[model samples]
Target: MRVLHIDTGLEWRGGQRQALTLHKGLLSHNIESLFLGNQAGELHQLCKNNHEEKYAGFAFNGELSLTTHHEIQNIVKEFKPTIIHCHDSHSAKLGSRFHKSCTIFHTRRVSYPIKFLSRYFKYKNIDAHVCVSEDIRNYMKQHFSNTFTIHSCVDIKRFDRVVNKTIFDKNGDINIVYVGAFSNQKGVDVLIKAFSNLAKKYNNIVLHLIGNGELLQPMKTLAKALEIDHNIVFYGARKDVEDFYLNSDYVVCPSVSGEGSSGVIKEGMAAGKIVITSDLTANKELIDDGINGVMFKTGDSNALTMSLTKVINKEIVIDHQKIKEKVSLFDCSNTIEQYITLYKKISNK
Candidate 1:
């Protein structure tokens, strides 16, 4: 069966990555697939550089664009996909517009509760709601029917190759890495405060932050103000993420707000590194509190500082094998299989 994946994100975040990966995976399985997405972002460049033949960098304009509506109608008529998978909110709404042509599936990654009034009609055309985490599904179940959990997965093969990058020049410094957007939701501020407290007593400590957003400058200012600028390194959205993971002794995801799941936690654990995250319900599903990883009170810098201290002081240790084995359950290949099965199951009816 043919499938069309629509992702409207202008940035190459975890959701876009998953959509692209799934499209590629379906093509490899001899299933017809096409990715219709924003012409902007690293995703657009990657598609052009590698798989232009299967990509459509559609400029959907905006939510109320008549041009976008007309274009989508034409695409649905010509492509006639059995399934249309919307990867973000904007595309989800757009996909719903032509639900009569094909089954609609929306991947909900956001964790915020929906408005009570809009909940009923928001996902009206969606045949299924594919949530990235169980916690997300549980919350979404209250707002929509046919919600299912499918964790956004990592490609384990990504860690197989060496990046040959130096993260630290020091002999035995403990390198900690945080790979995510620098936003209040991601808790970059909390991480800075915690790392500052950690760095005060530990000279051999280093924190590597990758990814960029509006908060980049603010977090940098906070780091300097906290007197931990020397111990902090900002790599700002590196393609060689595995390189940082390879060099890091620990991975920290200090998200203050809830989300579906974290790519950082998945990739870090997939690389067999201990992940330290906030005690969000979704995070708890992955981290077993100092077993596979460590969890601290959400938005609490003191708690995070203590959590980091445990790792640096040798008070916390994890079996890398256990970490790899756990995250392997979420390998991208497995997620592909699950999606294929779901697509066939729904399309048959």
Candidate 2:
């Protein structure tokens, strides 16, 4: 089956990664797939370097302009894909314009509820609505009829091949890593506060803040104000995140808002590291409390501090093997199989 995946995001976030991974997975299975994204986007550059033959570019100005509409029409006519998968809001808007001629499937990666009529209409035009988490599906199901929940998957082999390099001091400093956008929704402030408290108690603790966003400088400022800037290292956005996952003692996802099954959680589990995440509906679905990973109260700095202390003091034991086994279900192969099934179902109709 031929598929066309479109994403208008300028940055390479979890959703963009998923789209690229899915395109690669589809190609491996001998299913023709192409990725169309912003010409100046990070995803476009990465895809051009890796999957150069299958990558397509368009000049997107964030909104649905006449140029974007013309480009979509040209691509649809040229590719003639059996399925057109929209990976973001902007792409979904463009996909909706061609819903009558082709099967349009939108993957909702965020858990935020759709309250606007225009947004609801855009979704209504989609042939199938695939949600990355149950929390997202629950929100979309209320308005759309063909909503399906498919959790995001990671390329586990990438994590497995990471060379374990020593990132921390040899004096046994507990290195904690947080890999996500530096935004209020991701609860960067809460993580900083929690890390500040932990750093005051233990001098051997360090927090590595990876990824970048509009709130990056603000988060760094907060670390300085807390007087824990020395304990936190801001890596901005790095391509070699597997190294951070491999060397860290723990991975933390301190999101205040609900996530659509965070890729950070899956990546940590795939690396066999203990992931400490906020206790939300979607997070609870992946983590079984103290079993595979641990969860703290959402947006609560004290709760995060306590969870961190548990790991530092050896109060919590992590079963690396069990974490790997649990994370296997979300492998990219399994996600591809499900998507193939969905594609067949839609194509038959």
TM-scores, in order shown?
Answer: 0.96, 0.95
Model 1 has how many clashing residue pairs?
A: 1
Error of 1 at 264 (Å): 0.5
Q: How much is 346 displaced in model 1, in angstroms?
A: 1.7
Give the Å error, residue 263, model 1.
0.6
Model 2, 1-349: lDDT tens digits are 7899999998988988899888888888899998898998998888778856688899897555898889888999999887889998888888878877788999999888775875656676889999988888888877878999888998889886847586543313688998999877899999999998998798778889889999999998999999988788888888889988888889999998858989999999988899999998999888989889999999999999999899779899878777988899999999999999999998788
Per-residue CA lDDT of model 1 for 81-149, tens digit only, reads 889999988888888877887899999888988666546565788998999999999998887778888
Model 1, residue 289: distance off in Å is: 1.3
User: Roughly what TM-score does model 1 have, to 2 decimal places?
Assistant: 0.96
Clashing pairs for model 2 are none
Candidate 2, run of 10 with poorest lDDT: 164-173
